[model samples]
Target chain A: MKLRDFVLRRIILAIPVIFGVLTITWFLSYVVGDPLAMYVTERTPDAAIPGIIRARGLDAPLVVQYFLYLTALFQGDWGVSTTTGADQPVLTVLARLFPATIELSIVAMSIAIVLGIPLGIISATRKDKAADHVTRVFALIGVSMPIFWFGLMLKYVLFYQLSVWDLPHLPGGDRYNFRAFGSWQPTTGFLLIDSLLFEHNPALFLDAVVHLIMPAFCLGYITLAIITRMMRSSMLEVIKEDYITLAKSKGLSERVVIYKHALRNALIPTVTVIGLAFGGLITGAVLTETIFNWPGLGRWATNSILNSDIAAINGFTLLVAFIFVIANFIVDMIYGVLDPRIRFG
Target chain B: MSDELVLHVKDLYVNFYTYEGIVKALDGVEMFLRRGDTMGVVGETGCGKSVTAKSILRLIEAPGRLDDGQILFFDQDFETKETIELDLAKLELEEMLEIRGNRISIVFQDPATYPNPVFRIGDQIAEVIELHQNLAMDVLYMKIAKLELTLSEATSDENRAEIEGKISYYRQQLDDPPEPDKKSMREAAKLKAIEMLRLVRMPAPEQVVNQYPHELSGGMRQRALIAMSLACNPSILICDEATTALDVTVQAQVLLLLNQLKAEIGTSIIVITHDMGVVAETCNWVNVMYAGTTVESCATEEIFAKPLHPYTAGLLIAVPKLHEVKDRLPQIRGTVPNLITPPTGCRFHPRCDYATSVCKEKKPLLEELEPGHWVACHHPLRS
Candidate 1:
């Protein structure tokens, strides 16, 4: 099959998958009871409750409600946020917060890949040596340590203790200090990009970066460890292959043998883990965002869950499913590039 | 064949440091390859035929060390063109790199797994050629640039035709070009690779070059591997059971190809296998190994006609003959000894039917019982 047709087919196939996710989310929300309960209080009037339900189309038959939800979804009308954004359209709220999550995930993924792959290569190439042992220990710690605890510890050491010692320290939480910058207009919705581009303030950009370091590191640590471990084992297996011996016999330098020949084959498995981990990072950053006080989708999703905002929850689930499907598509594309057998097939 | 040795391995010892114990893989393996000679190193599985081949190029991986030995390579220096002898065992890895793939190349057993599946067959072959060749990239670029300019300026069809011919000539030279500048060298190596594929008699050399190893048949892959091994025109080519994994017909064809290539390229060949039929057909000289040590070395016909060492005779008898019918084929009395604590003296003592007190107590040296025929045995079957 042609590359274009293959890609298009994959994209077209994702529609049913997303639709299935939306249906499941709706059913789960139905079992959870009325989202309007969170809006109700002892001070609320009884007559107003029926009006609110009717206005939101909740009074319709189950089938009618399902069809209405699906219609609104396709018409670019994700329902209004109930508790989190307070009457703001869920899509708009998500859009406003989407860039922050994307920016954080990108930074976190960069940290994971940049550090993880090389650490893995070193660990495998020097298997059983001191370097390998050290990397193994580091990976063990990264995997074992809880992200929240790790983030707290980082704050305690790099922020609290350092500040007490009158040494240089980073901010404890939040994307950036709004009071210091007086809330410059967000051009890209990504504070890091906007701070530099629109405000033309290097200090704001640097502050955004500084604020990002701890959260990104904490979020990326597990992924980095996983990637490193995957890479090491994959590399070890690849180097044992007859082709690697042939490569060495060809008088290619050890560097080329490992990096050019073995590494590419080894990376096949590692890339798979990386793609899934990236999807996980984007949707699963709730704790990290909460701990760091960063205004990303994770924190909003957490609030929506706590509030039982069914519409928002359904939207978030569908979005997560979409991200995962896209990520897998990308991984498949990469596999095609990496392995010729896959490309031809 | 020339009297001068292309490679001489003396008292070669290799040990594998495994968690279980030290595997004495190669024990005093001694053999030599004369210039343009096709020598067969025949041995049962695990007898260290492959180990001996790998040791020649110092391609032993970690956990397996070249414990003690001298792998003397006789060659002429690249620049000086003066005859030189270097101990491959003692050469620094950097120095060894100069010899590997350039002066000595190896084709492995499994054709399926030996060529990287991800790379094009042509690119893989080109990589080996590019590693050894030192063609000038700038000259190639200049030649191409000059051709392009001449073609653009030429008004007559005849002049264009003449320029195109010169361009192709210069382009072929690009195939022999050298260095780290990847693009030009890759193009040059690719052109050379096509020529090599053709030399190995691969069908549609141009198309096969672009195909991956998995896309080709077992025989074709083996041929491609042979092409890669011969890309640099190495002085010595080691085939480590190169035909063991093929179909019977493919095996014969590969053997035939190897013989033809040896004669055409003038590269000394080491055909490592346990198949006596392969030895009978292809090898001029045979080196028989048993339990990590060479048991006999002689002309192929000499070894077959007058089987000496008890182990060699046992091996020969094991091969079923078409003329002689029997309920069960003649078999060696026992299995090969474990090399870790191999039979104290002659490693083959436990397995040899003719083992006596002397054979059990003392290791026999490889001695010349006849001119050009060496056997390591306390009791020679026909001495």
Candidate 2:
């Protein structure tokens, strides 16, 4: 198949999976807690419960609710926020929140990819040498530490008390006093860019980026350690194959043989672990999100649960479900790219 | 023989360090492959046929000590200088790199296992061309384009600019290109690989180009690997058990293809196999290895007519020839000795019918018993 066709085909395969997920989310919404009581009648008098249920259409049959939900989706409605009376649409919440979640996940995964791939290649190449031992030791340390505790420790040491370069209060999540900027001010939701906007100088961007140094590092490191170890193990296996020996015999540079011929083939197995690390990022390392006070999907999901806001919870669940399905679909398409033995319409 | 002596290995020893002791894999093995000749090296399993092939390119890893050897290549001199000993200690990484794929290429057992699964066959073939054929853009295009027997109007300057624009967009992967818009560079590589596939007599060469390894049958995949191996028109091709996995019918076909390839390209071939029949049919010269050492080496007709080495004689009689049906195929007694701590003196002594105290006391070197026939045995003088 042409590469473009392969991608489009994968997207089409994801449709049913996406639909199935939303359907399950919808079913579980009803099964979990009394949505009728939660949304409309928990505060209402007992005599008025039926009238309230009837008014809001909950008294309708289950299949009817399902059909209505499907219909509402087609009409560009993702249902309403039943708790806040905010009139915000589920799509609107998702559109606003998805970027933040993606950005965080991207940051965490950037850490995994940047650190993991090289560490893996180096460790595999070195094998039983000292470099391999050092990487293994560091990877063990990174994997053993709890992300939340790590994040909190980073915040405490780097930001709060001694004020080591007093990093700007966590951007967006921790709102800083604009007046504190004194002679300089900037506009934009992204703090690094905003800090650079006023003076059109990179110093402020650097300062903001410098602040980004710790939190993003903390967020991405552990996953990097995980993916690196996985990549190293897989790379070692591929290097042993006769074809790899053939590749080396071809006079390919040792680096080229390992990366181009060996690692690309070996990457098939490591992809799954890296994928899990990505999902961990998206769903939120709850502790990391909480410790850093980063108002991302993880925090959003937690607050909704505490507030007992069914609409918010369901929206978050469905959003997470969407990310999970799409990530796996991407992983599958990548699998086909890597192995070529897999074929699916 | 003087001009064609491309590789000469003398007393090649490969020892691997293990917990119990050093594993002697290849023990003082002497081997030689001349240019333009297909030399079949046959031995039973664990007999170090693979170790010998790997030793040519110096592919053995650490813990595997290359105790000795010389592997000569086709260099500028084309005479004695061309013959480099297959010594792991003498060459550096840079020297080995120049020799490995450029001078010699290897086609392994499974074609499917050869090309990396992720890359398109086109990219894989094109990479070899890109590295080896250092030519300017248009000239390179014409050279490759000529091989396909047609040059597109797209090579014209006005058309070239247009194509470059399309290529830029392709690099971006903006959207799906139409059929005519497929990357010509990629298509060029595909054309080359397909041409190779056709050269090896794989049917529907065009059909298998875009297909992955698994899509091709085992025989076809082996053919594709041969196609890849010949990508550089390598002076020496190592077929490491090239037909071992194939059935008899397919094996014959692949052997025919190898013979044809050798004739057409005039490249020396090292056919590594355990199949004596294949050696008889496909090889002009043969090396019989026993427990990591070459016990006999001779011209095919000479060895078949007057086998000398006890192991070689035993190996010859062990299998029944299709024409000479017998009630019981003669068996060579005793399994191959453990390589980790191989038996001292002659490794094959326990299995040899002629193992006297003298035979067990010393390992014999290949001694000329007749014109062009060398045998390693205490009794070769009698033969």
Best by DockQ: 1
Error of 1 at B265 (Å): 1.1
Q: Tens digits of per-residue lDDT for model 1 on B204-314?
A: 999999999989999999999999999988989999999999999999999999999888988899999989999999999999998889899999999999989988888
Model 2 CAPRI quality? medium
CA lDDT, candidate 1, residue A129: 96
For B1-383, candidate 2 gives per-residue lDDT tens digits of 34357667788888888888988899988887777778989889889999888887788888787877665554433455443444444689887776666567787886657766666655665566545543234334434445334225445677666665655544443344233322554455566777777888888887777766667788987887788778767778999998888888998999998998888877889999988888899898999999999999998886677788877777788877779868888888889999987877788888877778887778888887777888888766356
Worst window of 10 by summed lDDT in candidate 2 chain B: B173-182
lDDT of each: 0.89, 0.73
The candidate maximizing TM-score is 1
Runs of candidate 2 exceeding 4 Å displacement: A1-16, A26-95, A161-211, A336-339, A343-345, B1-4, B72-89, B133-211, B323-325
lDDT of 2 at A45: 74
* Chain A only: TM-score per candidate: 0.96, 0.82
